[model samples]
Target chain A: MKVAITSTGNNLESKLDLRFGRCGYFIIYDTETKGMEFIPNPNKDATEGAGPASVQLVASKGAKKVVSGEFGFKVKSIFDSLQIQLIVLKDNEKKISDIIELLNHENLN
Target chain B: MFTIFVLNICSLFMSPRPSRLRKISNPPVISGFRPYGNKNIKGKVEAVFLHFEEYEALRLCDYEMLNHHQASVLMNVSRPTLTRIYARARQKIAEALVKGSQISIEGGKIYFDSEWFLCSSCGCYFNNPEKQVEIKECPLCKSTSFSVYAENNNNEEEEEEEEEEE
Candidate 1:
């Protein structure tokens, strides 16, 4: 499955409505092929509605799963519509590579 | 100094004829205020009320330290409108801290800012925590299988392209 991973500057990733207007970088991954790619978050300037834009960008690229520390309501809605999955990373985790390993583990379950 | 003086004079003249300065809006009022140094008292204020939009304005203007223009862009609002929101937020926060009043955040027209989805194929975006995501066709593209996009060395280049597009 195609997956997208995002890195955040902090913990406390809230619901998308509360934090939709923020943007960070994302890493796209494919579980079956173990392939990965990068896409610049176009919603970086957003402080409130970053969710919609971020989800749209990922959806446009055909992402099926999105791994990140937190997400907000708007992004959640878009992901719901596009059928994109959201993965919550542990608090204080910064490295995207570490999260990828976690994702690999989750895929097994 | 000169700008303030001109504004005062303009206000005096325009007060009688509102149409002359219809486009020039008044700066938002400070809803509350009190001295900060006297906060050692028993009834000291511990919080400040912030309207959602006003807090949004503060985040956009003060915390982010964005200029009115930049703030306007970020909030998807006009510079004048952002200025009004920022002014109100600063006033409320100042009042709460100075007057020893518990801040109760409220008011201001706000809306959800973004959209999202849960991938049906991977079950990544599903809301229910208990239910398992059943694999189907890829919801994003209707494909049975998919892969993530490759990272390109296009940060600077893409920024340049965006600027050009703008």
Candidate 2:
């Protein structure tokens, strides 16, 4: 299974981005292969419909679960329809590395 | 006055639009009920399709012990509409009981309200996007200390007051 986490930077040490649609980067982490790929958000500066666009980007990566600080109202229904699990972490100080570790722990359990 | 009267007459001839979709705070746990042990000879047992909105109306009015006006506000519909829904729900239930028919709860012009949760460990608010799965721990820190966030009734009251002022 693969999980996507919104991040403030392209590196694992970057903090978790608080906003989902306008996040700086999206980290796609594969559980089985333990591989990570960072995709810069193209919709970061978009004035409208950023949430749905970001959802499309993440969906294209085949992410089963998404971790973010918050999700927009428009994206919630779309995600629900897609049957993609959403995990909200409120801690803005949380790093990408810590989130990946938590995902790893969850997979092990 | 003559133009206004003509406009009113024309409006009366037009068909009324459908009611707005009711907002359901929570989906029912079970799909519906079934009648059993019927000795009467029957070719087929008729099934009553109870809409989700009607089920919600029944729940709010009967199970929750709320008045029609209060339930209407909660459901985001007018009081008359809520009463109509409640009446329909009761009638369907009664029909199902008397006729030994199955009651299936599905299909309605309703939207499910998302529930918000507050994580004490991380001090963040989040909502459960998926309704099927139960949330056990905080998604960020994996902390179990959390609480279900309740809608603030005071906010609605304040909004009403502001509208009154306007």
Candidate 3:
């Protein structure tokens, strides 16, 4: 399954599969297949409504799961509409790579 | 090609003569992807408080190279306020560069200017306001500047004579 990680800089993955239009980049990883693609977020100039833009960008990447730090209500609604799995950071301290490792472990079990 | 051309045409209509000024406001926002395989779990996120308005001011007056008076008018702030903003901005930016802190683009008592400027010299562009003071020097080059594709009309006679000679 292709999983998309929402990140800020090099750490902090999205806990839920949500992005504000303001985020800079996304990393797409294939859990079963071990493929990865880095995508720059497309909504650099969006003045408002970041939730829709984030969802559209992720959907374009054909990702099934999303991990991020926080998910706004508007973003949560869009992910619900799109049926994208959303996970937020539990302790708000886990690094993005650690989250990816956890996801890989989940897939194996 | 069509889109770029259309954007250029639109830009021409937007600001025929860009002023050499900057504003004081929130800092530039930065967002980007993580490098692959950065698994280190412990790093403190640091923030530098330059404010977006401060950045706007510097961009207009310093980078865009507008005089203080012109930049103040573009930002819709009084000249004195702009001067203060610019000074503070410079100090903070200098500090940030020296100290290495994350610059945050939040919380400022500033508003966006309605007008924007395009540089005639290097094609570097900025957004500012109309009714600004007349600017003489190019912000980037410090030379007397003109608008892109703008003809001085007075130079036309000289050009005609040169053409005739040729």
Candidate 4:
């Protein structure tokens, strides 16, 4: 399963971004293959409709699950309809590497 | 001139106001229900479409035993509207039971009320989006010491929002 995590920086050491829509980078981590890809958010500076646009960016990558500090209501409905799982991780100090390690657990359920 | 102005004002009142979106506290765990042992039945009836609002109305009015007015306030609709939805829900359920047709819950103008959980071990807040699967551990810390995060706090916040809107 591919899990997406919002990152404040392009590197794995960066803390998790608090805002899903305006995040700096979106890290697509494949749990099965143990691969990760970072995509800079195009809607990072958007004034409006950033959430939906970010959702499109994330969805297009075919990520089955998303990890973020928060998800907008509009984005939540879209994700719910797509049947993608949303994990709201509201820890400001959490790093991308730590999250990846957490995901690596055989029983992360 | 006065008569013309009166007629214009009457026309403005004729148009219906935009409806408020209904709030669903929780989605149904299962999508829909199917009838079994209906091979002896004469015909296959089309599935009954149960709106989320209707489901919520039935749940509040019948299951939770809340009166129409109380249910309406929870659902963000008028009392009469809640009664109407409850009526339709019962009608559809009765039809499904008698006719052996499937009942599908879907498609309504509604927004969700999020339920947040707090993990004591990790000191993190999380939510369970999938209604079927149970939350077993903290997503980050892998701890089972989590609790329902903000039951009273959320209620107070919602009440505050209601006051602000009013």
Q: Per lDDT, what order, best first? A: 2, 4, 3, 1
Report the lDDT of model 3 for residue B108: 62
Distance (Å) between predicted and true CA of B11, model 1?
Answer: 77
- Rank candidates, DockQ, best first: 4, 2, 1, 3
- Model 3 per-residue lDDT at B79: 89
For residues A1-109, could you state the per-residue lDDT of candidate 1 as single tens digits? 7777665532223211212235455666787788877655667885566667777777777777766556766566666666556654333434555555555765555
Q: Could you tell me every candidate's TM-score relative to the true structure? A: 0.35, 0.53, 0.35, 0.54
- Best-performing candidate as measured by DockQ: 4
Ten contiguous residues with the weakest lDDT in model 2 chain B: B124-133
Span of ten consecutive residues with least summed lDDT in model 1 chain A: A11-20
- Going through the candidates in order, the fraction of native interface contacts each one reproduces equals 0.11, 0.31, 0.00, 0.39
Candidate 3 docking band = incorrect
True contacts kept of 2: 0.31
Write one digit per residue (lDDT tens) for candidate 2, span A1-70. 8888999999989999989999999999998899999999999999999999999999999997788988
Regions more than 4 Å wrong, model 3:
A10-19, A90-92, B1-166
lDDT of 2 at A40: 98
- Model 1 Cα lDDT, one tens digit per residue, B37-76: 5646676455575766776677666766778888777666
